[model samples]
Target: MNPFDYEVDILPLSVEDGGGFTAVAPELPGCRSDGDTPQEALDNIYDAIGCWIEAAQEMGRPVPQPRRAAA
Candidate 1:
């Protein structure tokens, strides 16, 4: 399954936060990325999700499934 299938929350960061876009996968704890643009943040988070899943699998940890889509 593609990691992109997982739900992601993208938000704008404040100046104190470095003023970049932040993308986070709520289902995958600590799986997030930041970029200058929304598209870039999303792209980075995709890679992060993959790595998160791979690392979990390697350590024999349970990888959370994607949340169900709303009707």
Candidate 2:
């Protein structure tokens, strides 16, 4: 499965929170990452998604399919 196929939610962090951005893959629980910018956050999350899927497969866990937008 392609990691980019999954939807990612990007949120900005406050100054107190280190002033970066966080990216999360909602469909894959506990899969998330943070970066100094939104684009960086997205890049990090994509890598995380691949790792998450790989670990799940190695553990014999079922990987959830990504939801697609309607036409």
Quick one: best TM-score, which candidate?
A: 2
Residues 1-71 of candidate 2 have per-residue lDDT tens digits of 99999999999999999999999999999999999999999999999999999999999999999996523
Per-residue lDDT of 18 in model 1: 94
Q: Please report the candidate that would top lDDT against the real structure.
A: 2
TM-score of each: 0.91, 0.94
CA lDDT for candidate 1: 0.91
Candidate 2, residue 53: lDDT: 100
